[model samples]
Target: MASLPEGALMQRAAAGLAYAVIGHLRGRGLGGVYGKRVVLLVGSGDNGGDALYAGAILARRGVQVEAWLLADRAHSGGVAALRAAGGGVVKLSEGYRSLSGSQPSVVVDGIVGIGGKPGLRPDAEEALAMLAGVPVVSVDTPSGVCVDTGEIDGAHVTADLTVTFGSHKPCHLLDPAASACGTVQLVDIGLRLPKPVIESLEAADVADLVPRPAPDGHKYTRGVVGLRVGSATYPGAALLAVSGANTGLAGMVRYVGTASEWVKRHNPEVVGDGQAQAWVVGSGSADGANSALAFARASGVPLVIDADSLRALNGPLGVPAILTPHAGELAALIREDRGDVEARPLHYARLAAKRFDAVVLLKGRRTTIASPDPDTPVRVNTTGTSWLATAGSGDVLGGLIGSLLAAGLAPIDAASAGAWLHGTAATLASAGGPVTASGVAAAIPAVIRSLPAVSS
Candidate 1:
């Protein structure tokens, strides 16, 4: 399957792109591409060819098409086809000021495709600078972005909508590049690429991954999540994490720390101490690393390591662990290994996964989940809002993942499901308003119930 031919793939991708651009324009009250002006920024590869062919179709529809050749050499066949269809290449010196006055409704950025290096060439950058104010639709991955790693090196284009081919690439899902790709629409090119290098979790995917309790299942049968968190100094973190875990998603919760009494007071169903199918270590346990490590080592099940527990990852964790780190903590982890997290998140996440021999969940605006195996496609969680970044949100996320692990999902599944559910719950709780950590926890059951039921 990996050996599928490329020529056939490019043709299908180009055709799909044409249809998508036409449909998008039509949807915006521009019926038929009749009087619209489209500028295609052509490069030196099949990507430029895709744009040239797409320009040919638009020209045939009576649309005024102009191809701005950025490369010294352009796609020969594509350029010929565009000229045959009445389109002409304009000199780059026409300056963006002149083009902005034309007010072209849509600009097609075909400057570079997936084969591009980290940043744009000086010439490419100069051309892009001219089109700054115009609305752009990027073909394939956004230009100047690390397609495989999802990093934006030097300068990159911010697209109004990115039309991706086949499956989604890492750049479409991982931040800060994901933020640049405004709205992503996948074009089915019928090319069976190898299993995706990275994947984003959708609502339906989360529904399928979240385990449902059996009708005859008891609390113990549902699987227990042991949480070792909270201290005299920061007791609220433990409370918030436990509050999230008690959303009727887990069979039972067991608290193991000095703040066990505090957790027991809020939710009496929690056991003082017992065996657990999963463990949630690190939260408000600022100085409680020893307790977190002890609990994690003893639990023999999947673990969700977050906040302070992340600092305790020096020793052998033994169980299937998921490390949740924000940019700061992640940067620290990267610093320990002489790497940079912000420069390349995907690379760092993958490295951490292998080094720890566990699943790694890097949290940010876009939460990324990666396993130790490089071939395993990273899962990005997209269903979140800016309000979800409020304080204590990470603790809630840890509890949710711990619940999934207790429900028997594997470490990766648990992390992905938890992130998805956490985002969904935040959306529901927000309802166009601000939401607190407690509100997010209260919204989990509704989010879970809203999921599409699985069919036999």
Candidate 2:
């Protein structure tokens, strides 16, 4: 209230929201919002206030706006503004569909705010279920999502777009809730917000974070990435992992264990078992994953632990390591159900980070990287496509991240950058077609070369 006039912030919010809706309608060939209908699913409190105010703006611009009141009361000032601008307000207890008269261009979900707990009242759920097909634009967040953790315990709005004010909340970046929010547009209302609870690495940010080799750098000086991956049962994993290491991001690549013959034939540049600045272990090492991890830990270098090795972990591993585990492996390590872990990825990723005292790279549609420090914001990687889910992909990611670690990026940076590059490479290689894991690995150099050089 002290920032400006009592309703100034809300007005700013409504203006942004109205513009977004107008743009959306025009993009959909609706000409403009001049005669289009927009239904605001308004409920108790400020969330409703934002929707009501936005509806007023739309009404003033000649849009037909209807407020479907879900509760007995709403933001009084916002309702007054809507009435003043000739917007219609209809109670949910009254006939719901009749007020709309026809299909709406969009549904603005302001039924509940972050303050409300997850799940909806029976009447609100029924009202929403009736408008299931309409595209929704959520204010702040999708109602019913656990704002801090992204958990959806009950009914929630699956928004086509979310116009969040100021900085993004955990819901915008974390999975489940993030997946529910189709696309997010941040609108600054000029509030001095606190530091983010979590962060995501954009493509440009990844380019800056990636290390560039010195002009006069030699092999040994560039830094070596040692790999202890692949087995007789899955030898292609070794090739894929080595391919990731050989992207020329690191100084040299080293291979230890059963797949050396295949490794040398394809990549003769790879050296035999030896010292390295960092070690990548576990992806497809199968039965020998534990032994390899022990050896890597003994090497006393930073490690990228993935796949089979993740399953073998019993404790912290007593090293500076990055734990790369998808839902199944994480579920096994944390002794939770895979379904539960998948649903609450952030919680488990953070729990595993604290428990292992290492960086946890939990892979999913949206990858999340959590550092051991509880205070540090977890980094979410929104890069890559579903095509990146192919077999041997994680192996490549592990080796790629291992190279960054050897090149001396922090564990979080290495994992986050590796994820960004891996995903971007997958996107390029796929080109709207099926892509193999090796293709993804092969595309890495091109992806790196394509990145804009970091600004001085």
lDDT of 2 by residue, 198-221 (tens): 888776788898888789989888
Q: What is the lDDT, from 0 to 100, of the residue 257 in candidate 2?
A: 77
Error of 2 at 120 (Å): 1.2
- Residue runs of model 2 more than 4 Å from their true location after superposition: 1-3, 95-100
Give lDDT per model, in order.
0.82, 0.89
Which of the numbered candidates is closest to the native, going by highest lDDT?
2
Worst 10 residues of 2 by lDDT: 92-101
Provide the lDDT at 142 for model 2.
90
- lDDT tens per residue, model 1, 119-165: 88887788877767877888997898988888887888888888998
Task: Evaluate residue 280 in candidate 2 and report its C-alpha lDDT on the 0 to 100 scale.
Answer: 95
Model 1, global lDDT: 0.82
Clashes of 1: 0
